[model samples]
Target: MPQEPVFHRYVALGDSFSEGVGDPDPTRPNGLRGWADRVAEELARRDADFGYANLAVRGRLLGPIVDEQLDAAIAMEPDLVTIYAGGNDLMRPRVDLDALAARYDEAIGKLTATGATVLMWTAFDAGWSAVFGKLRGRSAIYNELVREVADRHGATLVDFWRFGEYQDLRMWDWDRLHMSTPGHQNMAIRVLGTLGAPHRIEMDSLGPDLPTDKASRRRADLAWTKDFLVPWVGRRVRGSSSGDGVSAKRPTLAPIS
Candidate 1:
């Protein structure tokens, strides 16, 4: 059997997905304890020197994410790194996928050249969500680009685009944009498994089914549209972002405990 890999330092880069927006935890930084944090916590249990830093900020576009976080992550000299970007950019009315791919490829090349075990994720398939379904074709194209970049760089690929488990409504947060607690937990398990690392993390039970009645569903949808969708659209219109005044929750690597 192959020996399990050991990672002493781990750095996560990207936007809300990497930052853990949907998994709320008032006690943690940014009031969130996302999948990346969960992964770091588990890795910490396996190594005495494990340190982690997450530079992801919600609402950041691909350009700002790379400009702000890439060099900082490289400077940390982490043995393991995970990045999930471009989803925010895809949501825009227009995007130059070709140009975006070039930048993504370049960033991956730099991260890989550092000799770290880099992990990359394709955007999840959102065809089930009425709100995000429109971006399905664009997201698919970007996912393909991500695959090619990962192949060229030899980065571990976590194909989120194929996670059929996310088709379940419970796997998403109320906003329909980020993952729920169970979703984040599932991702942590996937990441560790890809690294060939043993972990005790398990998927949390989705205890009960949500109401399926048409009237009940309509009420819920209206509430979500009012509470989340409208504000999101307003932000786009105003050229603002949720992350505009937010700083990275974990800007430096330190022991998880």
Candidate 2:
């Protein structure tokens, strides 16, 4: 006789990014597979007992997530809950930062009321360029607000913005917003680390046809390095190029105690 599978219930709530927009695989029965699904897959592989329900919707904002999704998530009776939201709130016209924070607080409160361990992520700010500048500024504000709420609620705050920032822009789709396929895989790996889940298979191992060529790996690494390092270098170069009265010495790091 075949043995029944053990399962650890997990619930996720958020918007498109949490949905894994570019994950390449569509969820069985017509839903799009997002990072949440990828994370679920990893968890199951590592521990056959793991199970998850993703309540994320594409183009969802704080109001809908808080109002509709929260109830569904709580109904799942999850052992773990992951929240990734606020990007849509940032994109809305005339965003109310205070109200946004309040909604987040309420949502987290509800999730924790269920006695589930909570993991929330911060919003990304791709340094305000001509395109999406206003949205980026709002994202920065939202992230700060998220930080405060996470602290108040005692939820684990994973800084997705900083983590995503360190990755190559190519990880994102042409929209410069939603993640691409490789990005979803990378995000799953990071979330696994944050959750302290035992690693079983690397994401690369899952997609057999996906080549693991050295050149591809090298390019990804270089892209990540440049994404992280170039901005600081650029700032230095610009400061020096101005030939202002400001000293050009490299900024010193505070000594660790």
lDDT of 2 by residue, 1-257 (tens): 54433237777777777766656554342235666666677666645556567666666767877876788777668777888887766754467899889988988988877878899998765663334555666777788888998888889888877874434555666455677776777777787777776555354432233235899857755764577335534744564311123221101111111
Question: lDDT scores for all predictions?
Answer: 0.93, 0.66
For each predicted model, how many residue pairs clash, with residues at least 3 apart or on different chains? 0, 5
What tens digits encode model 1's per-residue C-alpha lDDT throughout 27-93?
9989999899999988898899899999999999999989999999999999999999999999999
Stretches > 4 Å off in candidate 1: none
Badly placed stretches (over 4 Å) of model 2 are: 1-7, 27-31, 46-49, 164-167, 201-257
Superposed Cα deviation of residue 112, candidate 2 (Å): 1.3
Q: Return the TM-score for each candidate structure.
A: 0.98, 0.71
The lDDT, on a scale of 0 to 1, for candidate 1 is 0.93
Q: Lowest summed-lDDT stretch of 10 residues in model 1?
A: 198-207
Candidate 2 — which pairs collide?
Answer: 7-49, 8-49, 19-34, 20-34, 20-35
